[model samples]
Target: MRTILAAGALALALGASGIAFAEPVKVGMITTLSGGGAGLGVDARDGFMLAIKLSGSKDIEVVTEDDAMKPELAVQIADKMIQSDKVDVLTGIIWSNLAMAVVPNAVAQGKFYLSVNAGPSPLAGAKCDKNYFNVAYQNDNFHEAAGNYAQTEGIKKMFILAPNYPAGTDSLNGFKRYYKGELVGEVYTKLGQTDYAAEIAQIRASGADSVFFFLPGGMGIAFMKQYAQSGVGIPVMGPGFSFSQDVLAAIGDAALGAKNTASWSPDLDNPKNKEFVEAFKTEYNRLPSIYAAQAFDTGTLLAAAAAKADVKDADAFRAALAAAEFDSVRGKFKFNTNHHPIQDFYVREVVKNDEGVLTNKIVATSFTDHTDAYAAECKL
Candidate 1:
C-alpha cells in the first residue's frame, strides 16, 4: 500500500510540472557567424535577444547556428535546426547565397522561413514558395534606390564597384534601370579583398562625377577609408547596409557625409524606431545595425502572430506574417506581390548623433511605395 501511494504521488508531481512548463515555441536562426562575417550574425543575435526580452513571455526559444559564411555549412545548420532542435520556424541569414541554400530546405520540410536579411531574387520569382517570406528587400532593391537617386541628382558619369558575385550583377543592373548615367566603369573586386587603392585610382581616371560602391563588412571599411583619401572629390554612394551604424565604428569620419539608400534609419520620425534605438543602445552600448533592426522586427512579428493564437499550426502563422500587420522598425512597411517589402527608401547621409555616435540622417526619399522587380515573375 505504501509503495503504490508513493508511485502515484510521484506521477502526479511529474504531470503537474509538465503542465506548468507546457511546450515552448521553437524558432531556428542561422547566419554567417564566422570567417569574415561574424559581425552580421552578432548584430542579428542582439536584435533577436532584445525582442525576446521585450516580449516578456517565456513561450519562445530560439535555436541559432552559424554558417561560417559557407553554403555547405548553412545546409548543415538547417538540418540541425530541423532534425535536432525540432524548430517550428526558421529565420536569420546575412548572405544572399547562404539564405538561398537554407530557405529551400526549410520550405521542403513545410516550415516557414522568415528572412531578416539577404533577399535572393530567385526566391521572389519562379521559385517563390508559400512558406518563405523576406523582411528584407530583394538583393537589388536598395541598389535601385541608389539608381533613382543618381537620376534625380542629375549624375551623368558614375563608377560602380561591387564584390564580384551574383549580387554584384544585380547591383549594377538595378542601378542602370533607374539611372540614365553614362557607365564610366563597372568593376568587380574580390569578395573579401581589402586593398581598394587600385580601384580608387581607376575611378579617379574614369572621370565619373559620382560613384556607387557595394562593399560590406571590413571591405566596406577599407573602401570608405580609401575613398576619403583618394581626393576623388566625387559624391560616393550605395546601399545603407554597407555604411550604416554597423560599420561606422570602423570607418569613423570616413563615412561622414557619405550618402546611401535604405528603408530604415535609427533616427526616423517614428515612435517604433525611437523606442528601438533607445532600447538597443542602452542595452548593447553600441548603435544597432540594420540587420539587428530587421531581426528584432521579425521576432516581434512572429511572436505577435503566435500571441494572436494564429500559430496553432505553422501555415496559419505564415499567413498572418504575410499580411504585414506587425509595426516594424521601418515604419509603414507593406508587402509587394512577390512577398518582399514595398517600403519607402530614403537617401541617408552619415552624421554624428547627440551622444557622439555616428548614424544616418534622412535627406530625401528615393522610392515611395516601391516594389521589387521579381513581383512580375511571381504568379501571386
Candidate 2:
C-alpha cells in the first residue's frame, strides 16, 4: 500500500507540473532565401534560429525553405508545410506579395501564422485573422515615419521611388499620406532593376529637395551606388529596408549620412536589445538589421507563448500569443487590436561604426506608439 501511494503521488506531481510531453511543435519558415533578396532572409533566419537556441526548448522543430521571392513558390511551400509537415505554426515570409499569397490560406486552415517581416495592410485590416499575428510593423509604418520626418524637416518637394509591386504601392501611398509635400515625381521602377541612370536624370530635373526610395536588399545597394556616382546632391531618405545593416557593406560610402525609418535598431537602449545585439554580433559576426531583430522577436515570442499553452490547442495558443509576454529587442512591444505591433519608429542615419563598418545609428523618434491605418477595418 505504501509503495502504491508513493507511485500515485509521483504521477499526480507529474500531471500538476503540466510539462509538455507531447510531440514536438513544428514550425515552418518560408522566406526569400536565395537570389537578390537573400541577405534579408538569411539574416532573419539566423536571428530566428538564435532565439530558438536561446530559448532552450527541446520540443520545437523548425523547417525552413527558400521561397526565392516568388509568390507561387511560397504558396506551394505553405501547402507542403501544412499538408505534409503538419506545422503547428507558420512564419517568415519577407515580401508583401508572398505574405498575401500564403498568410490568409494558412490562417484559414487553423494554423497560427506569425509574420516576422511582411505586414501587408490587407492582413492588418479587412482580412485580419484571429490565427494571424504580425511580429513586425505593418508595411507602411516605416514609410509613414519617413513622410512624417520629411514634413517636419519642411521639405516642400520630394521625389518618391519604389518597385512596382503591392508593397511598393503601399509604401508610396503611406509616404504621401503623411508627407504633406508636393511630389516632384512618383516613379515605380521594375522590381530588381539594377540601373538607375534614367531615374537619376529625372530626379536631377525634378527640382525636388529630397528623394525617398523603397528598394530593399540588392536593389537598394545598386541604386544607392549609382545615385551617389550620379552626383544628384539631394538628401536621400526612405524606409529602413533600403539602408539596413545587411546591405550597408555593399552600399558603402554612398549610404553615409542617409536617413531611413525603422522600428528597431541595434542601438536601442534596453537590456533585451543590448543582449540581442551582442549575441547576434557574436554569433553572426555582423550587425543585426531591423529584419533580424523582428525575426528574433518572433522566435522569442513563439517560445514564450508555447510555454504558456499547448500549440495543439489553437485558442489557448492564440491567447498566449496575444499576451506577448516576452522581452523584445524593440523596447516596448505590444500588439494592436489587429495583431500588428503598436510600437515606436525612429529615424536612423548611416554612420561608420568604430570598426569602420557602415551601420545605422538612431537619430530621432519618428513615431511614438503608432498604430496602422488599417486597424479600423479589422473586425477583430
Candidate 3:
C-alpha cells in the first residue's frame, strides 16, 4: 500500500511539473531543394533544423522534402503531408506560386501552415485563413520599401523589371505604390531567363535615372553580371531577394553598392539576431539570409506555441501561435489581422566584408511598423 501511494505521488508530481509525456509534434517542410532556387530553400531548411537542434526538443519530428520549385509538385506534397503523414504543421515554401498552390488547401484541411517565405497577396487578403501564418513579411513589403527609398533619393525616372509571374507582378505593383516617380520603362522577362542583354539595351536607351529589378536566385546573379558587363552605369535597386547572402558570392563585384530592401538582415541589432547570426555561421559556414532568419523564427515560434498547447487541440494551438511569444530575429515581431508580419523594412547596400566577401550592410530604415496593404481585405 505504501509503494502504490509513493508511485501515485511521483506520477502526480511529474504531471504538476509539466513533464508529462506527450506525443511528438509532426512537421512537414516542402521547399525548392533543387534547381535554380535551391540555395534559398537550402538556407531556410538549414536554419530551421538548427533551431530545432538548439531547442533539444525530442518531441518534434520534422519531415523535409524537395519540391523542385514546381507548384503542382508542392500541392501533391502538401496532400501527402496532410492525408498520409498526418503532419500537424506545414512550412517552408520558397516561391509564391508554390505557396499559393499548397498553403490555402492545406490550411483548409485543418493543418496549420506557417509560411517561412512566399507571402502571396491572396493569402494576406480576402482569402486569409486562421490556420495560415506568415513568419516572413508580406510579398510586397520589401518592394514597397524600395519604392519609398527611390522617392527619398529623388529618382525621377526609374526603369523597372521582373519575371513574368505572380510574385513579379506583385513586386512591380508594390514598387509603383510608393515610388511616385515617372516610370521610364517596365519589362517582364520570362522566369529563369539567363541572358539580360536585351533588357540592358532597353534600359540603356530608356534614359532612366535609376533601375529596379526583382529577379531573384540564379536569375539575379546572371542579370547583375551581364548588366555590369553592359556598362549601363545606371544605379541598381531591388528587394533583398536579389542581393541575399546565398547569392551575393555569385553576383560578386557587380552587385557592389547596390541597394535593396528587407525586413531582416544578418546585421540587425538585437540579441536574438546576434545569436542567430553567430550560430548560423558556425553551423553552415555561411551568412544567414532573410529567408533563413524567417525559417529559424518559424521553428522558434512553433516550439514556443507547442510548449503552451498540445497540437491535438487545434484551437488551443492556434491561440498559442497567435500569441507569438517567441523572440524574433527581426527584433519587433507581430502578426497583423491577416497573419502576416508587421515589421520595419530597411534599405541594405552590398559591401565587401573584412574578408573581402560580398554581403549586405544596413544603410537606412525605409519603413517602420509597416503592415501589408491587403490586410483590410482579409475578413479573418
Candidate 4:
C-alpha cells in the first residue's frame, strides 16, 4: 500500500510540472538542397541545426526536407508537415518565391513560420500575419545599402541588373529608392542563367561609370568570371548575396575589390557573434555566410521563446517570441511591428585574408537601426 501511495504521489508531482509531460516541439525545415542554390540552403540548415545541437535540448525535434528550389515542391512539403507531421513551427526556406508559396498559408493554418533567408515585401506589408516572422533582412535592405554606398562613392552614372523574378524586381527598385543618380541602363536576365556574355557586351557599351548587380549563387559566379575576362572593368558592386562566403572562393580573385552590402560579416565584433563564428568554423571547417548567420539567429530566437513558454500555448508562445530575449549574433536585433528585423547594414569589401582566401570585411556602415520601408504598410 505504501508503494502504491508513493507511486501516485510521484505521478501527481510529474503532472504538476506540465512541461515534463508535454510533447517536444516539432520544427519542419523545407529548404533547397539539390540545385544551383544549394549552397545557401545547406549553410542555413547547418547553422540552424548547429544551434539546436548546442542548446542540448531534447525538447526540440527537427524534420528536414529538400525543396529543390521549386515553389510547388515547397508547398506540398509544407502541407505534409502541417497535416501529417503536426509541426509546431515551419522554417528554412532560402528563396523568396518559395517563402511566398509556403509562409502565408502555413501561418494561416496556425503554424508559426520563421524565415531564415527570404523576406518578401508582401509578407512584410499587406499580407502580414501574426504567426509569420522574418529573421533575415527584407529582400530590398541590402540592395538599398548598396545604393547608399554608391552615392557615397560619387558614382553618378550606374548600370544595374538582376534576374527576372520577384526578388530581382525588388532589388532594382530598392537600389533606385536610394541611389539618387542617373541609371545608364537597367536589365533583368533569366533566372538561373549561367551565361552572361550578352549582358557583359551590354555593360561594356552602356558607358556607365560603375555597375551594380544582384545575381546570386552560380549565376553570380558565372557573371563575375565572364565579366572579368571581358575586361568591362566598370567597378562592379552588389548586395552581399552575390559575394557570400559560400560562393566567394568560387568567385575567386574576380570578386576582389568589389564592395557589397550585408548585415553581418565574419569580422563583426560582438561576444555572441564571436562565439558563433568560431564555433561554426570549428564545426564545419568553413566560414559562415550571411545566410547562415540569419539561420542561427532564427534558431536562437526559437530556443529563447521555447524556454519561456510551451509551444502548445499559442498566446504565451507568441508573446515570448515577440519579446525576442535571445542574444543575437547580429549584435542588435529587434522585430518591427510587422515581425521583420530592424538592424544595421554594413558595406563590405571583398579582400583576400592572410591565407589568400577571398572573404568580406566591413568597410563602412550604410544604415543603422534600419527599418524596412514597407513596415508602415503592415496593419499588424
Q: Which candidate achieves the best TM-score against the true structure? A: 4
Give all TM-scores, in the order shown. 0.92, 0.96, 0.96, 0.96
Model 2: runs farther than 4 Å from truth? Answer: 1-13, 20-23
lDDT of 1: 0.85
Pairs of colliding residues, candidate 4: none
TM-score of model number 2: 0.96
Question: In candidate 1, what residue range of length 10 has the lowest lDDT sum?
Answer: 15-24
lDDT per residue (tens digit) for residues 1-380 in model 3: 99999999998888777725566789999998998788999999998998888777778899999999999999999899888899999999988889988988888889999999989998899999999999998999899999999999889999999999889999999999999989999999999899999999999999999999999988999999999999899999999999999989888898999999999888889999999999999998988988899999999999888887889989999999988999999998898988898889999999998889888899999999999999999998
RMSD of 3: 1.9
- For model 2 the local lDDT of residue 145 reads 98
lDDT of 4 by residue, 37-154 (tens): 8999999999999888777677899999999999999999999999999999999999998999999899989999999999999998999999998989889999999999998888
What stretches of model 3 exceed 4 Å from their correct place? 1-13
* Cα lDDT, model 3, residue 355: 83
Q: Indicate the TM-score of model 3.
A: 0.96
TM-score of 1: 0.92
Error of 3 at 288 (Å): 1.1
Candidate 4 local accuracy as lDDT? 0.92
